[model samples]
Target: MWTIYLGLTGLAAANPQVVGLGNYTGALEDPRFLTSLWLTVLYVGGSAIIGQAGLGFTLAGILRTRTGPVRRLVEGVVLLSWIPPSTVVGFLWFALLDRDEGTLNALLHTPGFAWLLDHPLLSIIIFDVWRGTAFSMMLYAAALENVPPAHLETARLADAGVLQQPRDVVFPASAATS
Candidate 1:
């Protein structure tokens, strides 16, 4: 209610006045607003759909066949990225991407590359993917369990390639959950 009232009137400003729709119109007309909106859509869609879902599904599929310490180690590392608080994760990523003394810059031998400023959208999308992939991985891991081992074995015996097994057998079995 307060937000609507503020948006409808000029009461939010130092000098209050009844400027109904002016604020909304101004925001709509601003080029920066449009750019920010577009970037936001792109970032979220790319991260959630392309990056997180795809990578998580792939990881889950690969890990489904494996067992023992290798699987545990990979799952632990992925979950560690998702388990931390957002603030802690943000601070760590900030340190990693910082211009002068960042770990990334040091590793790449690019001393002063401003990653956040130069590639804000890409950075945020990648961060979101890293932060959110564990959920997708776990979800797909459970879903992949629904896929019958017999079906996978049948596909393998039929000479299905690595990608074909997932597309034909695993995907059909897991489509409901997906």
Candidate 2:
């Protein structure tokens, strides 16, 4: 992959003397590198899996039933977040959390939390959730649309509400389709 090539190129450029297992051992011992790995795992699990999965499914279910101006507006907002460049998201978050006079601190009327210095991991995790939830919403919207209306109606006739209907009918329908 181009990714491997790029990584190797950067490695070779950064440390010409670094070779083979030595580089690997050095990297493994690097605290910053290790912390980066942990942060990545946390972000993937917390934001991508948990935040995205739950919110996406919930929004998709709503979009499936609700149609009109409200749905259109919400979809537009989600799509806007989904399409922005990563750098823009990072910049926007930086502004929002900029300790000294960040709007969040002002609005919350609390002392600034030293996020960038002390809790960069949590800061990035929050950023990831905010930026990535829309993607999950979009994916789930498609998934929800594919569920059969007849099945939903049948589940309703069986005296099932939202939770029961989705659990008994929608999830099984999705599983079979997948």
Clashes of each: 0, 0
Expressed as tens digits, the lDDT of each residue in 27-109 for candidate 1 is 99999999999987898789999989999998998999899999999999999999989999999999999999899999999
List where candidate 1 sits over 4 angstroms from the true fold.
Answer: 1-34, 176-178
lDDT of each: 0.92, 0.77
Note the residue pairs that clash in candidate 2. Answer: none
TM-score of each: 0.77, 0.71
